[model samples]
Target chain A: MSRIVLEGISKIFGSKQVEGVELIRQGKRKAEIAAACGAVVGLCDISFDIVEGEILTLMGLSGSGKSTLLRCMNRLVEPSCGRIMVGDVDVTRLGRKDLLAFRQKTFGMVFQHFALLPNRTILSNVGFGLELKNVPAARWNEAAMQAIELVGLKGWEAKYPHELSGGMQQRAGLARALAADAEVLLMDEAFSALDPLIRRDMQSELRDLQQKLKKTIVFVSHDLDEAVALGGRIVLMKDGEVVQIGQPEEIVARPATEYVARFVEHIDRAAVMRAGQVADRSAPVLQPTLTVAEARIRIAGEGGDAWLVADDDRRFVGCLLAARLAAARPSETVASLLEASGEAVAAESRLDALLARVAAEGCVAVVDPDGRLIGGVGSRDVVRALAAHSAESQAGDHPETSILQQTAGAERWTGASRNFPSTRSATKASTGSPTMALG
Target chain B: MLTTALVAVPPWVFIGLAALATYRIGGRKIGLLTLFGLLFLWNLRLWQATVETLVLVSLSTITALVIGIPVGIWFALSRRAWRTFSPILDMMQTLPSFVYLIPALPFFGLGAVSACFATIVFSVPPVIRLTALGIRNVPTELVEASDAFGGSTTQKLFKVQLPLALPTIMAGVNQTMMLALSMVVIAAMIGAGGLGRAVWQSIQRLEAGAGFEAGIGIVILAVILDRSTQALAARARPHGAA
Candidate 1:
């Protein structure tokens, strides 16, 4: 179930909000509404759901209302008009006292700056929420110590905020939120201020922490790489409206608009696309017990230099090279001709990690956790995916694609597709019955 | 009562108490130097007068801080209250110390209490202004964080805002004590006896050597009070509860 849902949320920064809201309902864009009523639209009818225990990233360039939208969740920056439901409660209608309690119990917030009280020690800062509620010192201190240990600052709890490095300070900030044990965490550009290497470390640490804690986290970031690193669904915003909402792979593969296409122009597809997504599921699956003569007939109409051979249970045995199969005895089993050169990777492995394997082996098989083959990722399939991604991003000026093009060996890979020998080319022509007849 | 003690107490006892306090606050070197300076004042025959000035300055600074800190806190927490009271504080600060003494004489008559009253009026502004500035200058982000964490208005004020603002407020207290010390000589014009009376007597009889002795005695008292309070304020610096 969706843990938090925002409906028709709109925030106008200036007066004439009534008129501004009316124009927004009439489908006026931010600038048009601003010109018409002299009220700046901060969020224009923004709506989305935050599923429970998912790290949903609200991503955009600065001034795109991503942070504003995040604040709207806890009503820190109240939405001008909307219905916000966390569980069954209508958060928009919560009174000051009730809202304060609800926010304290439900939402934990981490900011761009660490925001640790400079006067307080790390332990006190972490336990600040509990101390606010007048919890006994023993209980709050115990909770604070646990959180500090969780963030790897166990001994530093007695130190001042200024004594720690920027990264450690942010860890303390995160520990402060964790100490409260809130069901949801709203992290607003939490790692953006850190040095790049530390920023990456924090991202991974957050990812690991979220997995263990299972907190419904809404992360806000301007960097797409950070969003992808968090490995969550992303809601891309532009000009106070959601542009597209999907996983990084879906968004990169099929951007919903030109604005979104431009936003993802420099995204490293290898990092976002998983091995499963890149695997060619249409490839013929050969049975291990099938005769070499029968396997030759099965792949004769296909365009692969080799076929992934799997048993009846779809357990991947190995690959059978076409040349090796052709040289074998007619009565020999396909398993007997199987080549050990092919690599098998977990389906969840990222495409960047699979690229080196792809370069080494002509094709790599993608398997589930149980080691059952899902499909194969060949050089042609990778080249095709890269070409499509580059073409989409090429609508804008993407200078970074030169690196990908070089690494992909664009000419050799693309030429391999066009000038492939006909003997191994079958699926492109005899698509229907021939391959199925052998099966 | 403090005046009676100053008159009855022996010179060595006063120096001994001061040295102990200075040792606690400013550490050994400063404490010994202050004791040496006090011994010089005793040799100059100004110990009684110096103690009287110390009593007056100490009493007035404590009173000013007690009154000024709360008023500053009230101003910091409420914009409306600040707007209303800021101009009055401005007027109190701008009006000369002698002008305050003119009104103070009729109200309290010529005495130590009247001198304390006038000196407080003269020195209270720095504490109030600085305390308000400290609270007001607390980072908005920390306040928002406190609020987000469910801290009530009172909780935030005491636990987060005030604690964070202490160093800045202590700086104000230091300023207030210095200002109070400066007002002591002027305060003596209204028959408030202390080092000021000793200086006043020398000026009247055209006694240059006595005047110089009393002047140096006041400087010595000022140094002790100034250095001790400054040391206290420095010690009070918020070091993350460490």
Candidate 2:
């Protein structure tokens, strides 16, 4: 179910007046001075749904209205037009009292600046949100302490924001959001200000937290990599409008427009595509009585150099020797070559895992439910997939899936393991598929 | 020299104590520098006179701060009141100290009260400015964060703004106190006892030794007060101590 929804939202500023009007000459249009400031369409016709217990990312360059859209979600900056629904409530139409209550109970936000009170200790800062909500002092502190511990800042509660490093301060900000216990978390460039190493660590930590807490999150970022890594779906924005929205792989494979294509142009595709995308499904199956020479011919005909020797029940017994296929006699199963083997990966495994497996095994094979070889993939294929995904992602031809989808798909591929061969030529031919490769 | 010692010792003792307290609050460098300044005053033979000057300055500074901080906080909290009083504050800051004596002498009859009144007026600006600046500079994001969490205006001000503003406010207090000290010495011209009186007496007799002794004493007191207050300010900061 969608936990939050924004429909046909638009924000226009200074809509009425042109430039170079003197205040006296402008007269009462001066009272409409806001209208004279020139129209800035901060967000135009933006619409999306954030599913319950999912991480949705808004991705855009600076001035693209990603942050503005996030702000409008909570009425931090009121939208000129739109209906924003948090559950059954039309948040855009909320009165001041209702808005305040909604902000306290329904949403929590984290900013890029860490937004911690410089004067307060880490504990106090963390508890600040709860305190505002009128939680009793005792209860607030307890909740704050738990949040601090969650962020790995157990012993540093008494320290002030200035005493901590930038990363620690951001953690405190996260703790503050956690303490609030709101249903939805809104993060605006929260990790963008951190050093690269710290940002990566925080991203993993946030993922772990999300796994455990299952809170709905809407994160905003300009970096495509970040969005792909942490978001379940991505909404790409440009010049106050949504350019595309989709799973990371879909976007990478087929960007919605040229603008999106430019954004994804530099991304590595291998990191974004699943092993299933490039895995060959036509590996040869060996019979129990097949000779090594016969097996070799069968394997070659199937476009594979290896054959799986499985028993009648389809239990993977061993691999077949292609060179000795002709000498093998009947009743002599290929299971003789079934020495201890490395682990096989599912076809759906992400490219990152696939790469790791290839690195560990020098080659990886994709296997089905019965342990039958579906395809083989190597390091080179992973790289190729990444490149192809990036090229397609920039084109922005695919708009069905939001940017959140692309991010989530990218993350899955980068984190899972699978087997496939390096099909550079095939990848080139499939220019439409987006590759999200982590370089 | 003996008379100089008598006058200088009391103020130096208090000044040293204040400096030490400030050092404990601020840091060691300020403490050491304050001690060095006291030593320089002793070398000038004005340590005793300076000590006497310190007592009046301290009293006046305390009085000003007591009145100034609350007023500053009130002004910060209320736009209407601040607008009403802003011009008054401006006038107070711009008015000459000597002008205060014309009215103060007749009302208070030329004594410690008169001197203190003049010193208070002179020292109020730093306290007010610092307090306002500190509160204003408190991060808007933090304020918003607190509000989002459910904090009331009182909680936001006390928990977020005031505490953060302490360091800057303390700095203002330090400046005010220093300014007060200088004013107290000037106030001594109007029968305000202390180092300023001693300097005045020596000048009347054309006794360079007595004047120098009193001047040195005042310098020592200044060093002690300055260091200690700075130390206190530093120590009160959220980052350094906690």
Candidate 3:
């Protein structure tokens, strides 16, 4: 379900002015001020849905209005024209008192500079947001302490900001956000200022917390890699408009635009696509099968190279491989050789998770959430995804379908290729039988 | 000699106490230096006149600080008050000290009160200027941080800004005290008894040794007061806790 929505949001800045001398020269009664500071269209016609419990990253360079867009979500910077709906409430139209209440309950913000109070200790700074909402001092303190512990700053709660290291200060900022217990978290380049090592640590910590809390997060970052690592769905932005929004793999494998492709070109795709992409599927039918050796030969001869071992109802029981038939015993079911293919199948996983899954499974299969196969992928898939992504990226044009098409052509051959009759016959049959080709 | 006793004891005694305070605060080397300077003035026999001058300077500096700090706070909190009073502050700082006696003597009799009044007019500027500057210079980001944390106006001012501004304000106080010390000797011309009276008496008699002694005592008092106040200011700083 969409937890938040922005529609037709636009912001323009300027005030009208009058020029008296010009008016007098023109023989006018009044010289009116045109809205002449020259309007700055900070955000123009921006609309998107952030699904519940998803990390939707808003990625763009400075002056690209990513920050402004994020700020608009919380009404920190009001949009000149738009509607922002969070759940059932229209946040854009909130009055001052209602807006304060909305902010207190709906969102917690983490900024680039940490913004911890210099005079207060870490505990107090973290509790500050809660304090503003008028939480009782004792309750807020306890909540703030838990938040501090959550961020792993348990022993350092008494220290002032100046006494802490830069990373610790940032952690305290995270703790402040956590303490608020708001439903939506807004991060504006929250880790940009920290050293690289600390930034990575904070990113992982945020990922871990997000997993546990399931809060809808809108993170803004200029770094594409960070976006790929953290975003469940990325909203690539340029010049105050959304360029693309999709799962990281979709952006990496099939970027919607040149600007998006430029971002995706550098990403490693094997790490972004899931195990289901390459997972071997069970054959559709169940038979009173022969010995494993006899079955392998018969299936190979019939052009059904991979065989499924299923119970009577045709439920997927296990898989059998042609290459392993010699080692199989007659009494042993195919389940013995079904070696747990550790590949992740989800298409929405990040590059880091994809990489980890690929490394674990040797090659991951990409699949939809229902466990239906989408495509087979290997290390070469990662290379090709990256190359195709980058090739079109370097061309700085529309989506690079040709490079991906070429790579897909190269990877079409497998151990099962020998079982299929002829490419010409297969092509002819594919034209008439789409379901057969899919199977 | 009796007149010398009345004039000399206060400046010399006060300076001696200041030298002791500096030695305690700043340690041995500064203490020895302060002690030697005091001894040099005593040897010159101008210590009596110096004591009298120290009394007037001390009185004026204290008075200026008391009046200046509240006005500085007012200026810091209210922009309108600052804008209105800034020109008056400018006038106070730029106006000549000598001109103060012209108007002051007519209202107050020629003695400690009139001399103190002249010293206050001359010395008060540094304290006020520094206090205002100190408060103004506090980081705006820090102020915002406090505001974000839900600090009330009073809490923000007292807890965050005031403590941070203290060192700068003390620096101003130190400077003001230095100016007041310098003006006391000049104020002696208005029949304020002090080292200045001794110098005047010595000059009338053409007694070079007596005048030189009184001048030396004034110099010793000046050094002691300046050094002690500087030490105090330094000690008041945030870093001093370490």
Candidate 4:
């Protein structure tokens, strides 16, 4: 299902390409290689597969080679050594003429500065790629007009790029890329030039468009927030190398390197972490069929104010509170004692939104899409979720208060923030019971 | 050829057409200036000499543009070519115009052909230099955008770089035209007859008054051509731009 696969890609920008590449293979770092042969290392042994119909962001600050890596996908910046495979074709091996034709058909690109041609009208600029393919004028214009309308520039088709405002110019740039109907979109800092408010709007709109169009996108960005806002797997890079690649939450939760941990240190943990990530999947659960006599014995080993109950099929039935169980008749079915307050938070719900619910209910059932009970999130779980971050360790004596202070005005973090389906922290020691103890 | 054909059109008709052309291109002020300017030339009996000079300048400029533009494009797109060919341009510009004329006299003989050959050699450098500058000055990001969408080299030139460079290229054309006009008097020494010939003949007879009259006629023509081309370049700028 991968649209593009890049393997052993290393680009050395200098006249001494062969020597620089050999140095790279021999494990010389960027500065060493550059000093030895006067070659600037642009990318060093980059390998990743772009999944079909997903946005993958290449993120790093300036000089990280993120932009160079994006350009290398379509061969705008050719790698000194690499194998590039796009849908079964070896893109690097293609002849010059064939590469041009393939590039024409396979990729639609947008630029950071809205690089629309100054002389052409929006309509003409949008249709430039089609014109290159010798697509007939009437057909290309129709396609272009459709794209213009799609990007909400319907009435401004006749205006030149200079006539449009910065945001509008960016929309026209997006329209131009969309008009090509190319299978993959490689956007290089496409919206970094826009103001923050407009950038957020463009990010959400692009996310929506990508879903609707189902085009695979590889977006390059220097901003971590932008990468998070785009809601894709982030490829964190530094010094011409990938430091880590994962969903935003996974990255924030478990950074592979000190560098990566530093990058995620300032990120709002509550805003990025999902309920599933904080869910106590190892917690013991009682079956609804169990009587009060049977549930009491089962709950003896587990320490909780309440226990989530599920049917045999693992469908979430409800939770049995200790107070409710204490008042129940011995022979009564556990199902009859199930509390009305029990509500399951979906596994995909952001942890920030469920803070009050978990506080009010003591605990809540975390369920999968089909209402299958996966685990539980309690007051402890919410506090633990917030406390697990590296930031908390730096918070000293009042870490909890410092973390809570951010939630007071965290409205900005809630802007169409996409959540990565958080993974269960199975590696942590069981605070409840062994896995699948849902008996 | 065009100068010879205009000889039969009569002075009044030529004046009327030129006035109309300036009016269409530069508006009322320039139209009026052309009207009075040519009338003054007629009154001075320098009209015939003026026409010959206009035709010669026009021919030399057109030829320089036709030959220089592609070379300029080649230089802009390839640095290796620019490095190799730029010295030739520098030499062409610095070499005394008469030095080339001495070498050219054998090939073109004398009269208008020799004059035209010298005028072109002296004038082509500006167009070539400016055309290369115009094309090269197109923002790198814009060119990258075109290439990102898979524009071929020729497609990028005609569609993106060429249109953006038009205003600059037109300015080059104006420079070439100006250079061509300045070469006319020098060309007169080779037997090409025009306002230049009048100036030359006046110089030979020590007639300072007639030489000044011919010089004034050339000045008027320079102003007219300069203003006309400036108007054209302004119009060539991309629409909706200030």
Candidate with best lDDT:
4
Instruction: Report the TM-score of candidate 2, chain B only.
Output: 0.81
Second chain TM-score per prediction? 0.93, 0.81, 0.86, 0.96
Give the range of the ten consecutive residues with the poorest summed lDDT in model 2 chain A.
Answer: A430-439
**Models sorted by lDDT, best on top:** 4, 1, 2, 3
TM match of model 1 to true structure = 0.87
Indicate the fraction of true inter-chain contacts that candidate 3 also forms.
0.10
lDDT of 2 at B29: 77
Per-residue lDDT tens digits for candidate 1, residues B1-242, read 86786769788887898798899889997799789999998888777788788889889999999999999999999999999999988998888778879888998999887888999999998899889998998888788888888777888899878887887788888888888988877888888887888787788889988988888888887887778777877776777444
Candidate 3 lDDT over A164-257, as tens digits, reads 8889998998889889898888888988999888888888888989999898889999987787667467777776666766666555545565
DockQ, per model, reads: 0.47, 0.35, 0.17, 0.64
- Compared with the true structure, what per-residue lDDT tens digits does model 2 show for residues A1-439? 3388776666665543233122212222222443545445566555666779988889999988888898888877777765788899988777777788888888889998998876578998898788777789999999999999999999999987888999999999999999999989999899999999999899889999999999998999988888777847778887677777666766665556667767877765555666766553444556655655555566664432344555565445544433444456644545555435745677656667677656655446666766766555655455545544553455355533433345443433433332332212212221212221100
CA shift at B120, candidate 2, in angstroms? Answer: 2.9
Q: For residues B5-93, write the lDDT of model 4, one tens digit per residue.
A: 98767998988999899899989988888999999999999988999999999999999999989888988899999999999999998
The ten-residue window of minimal lDDT in model 3 chain A covers A430-439
Q: For residue A82, what is the lDDT in candidate 4?
A: 71
Deviation in angstroms for A34 in model 3?
13
TM-score of every model versus the real structure: 0.87, 0.72, 0.71, 0.86
Give the best candidate by TM-score.
1
Candidate 3 CA-lDDT value:
0.67
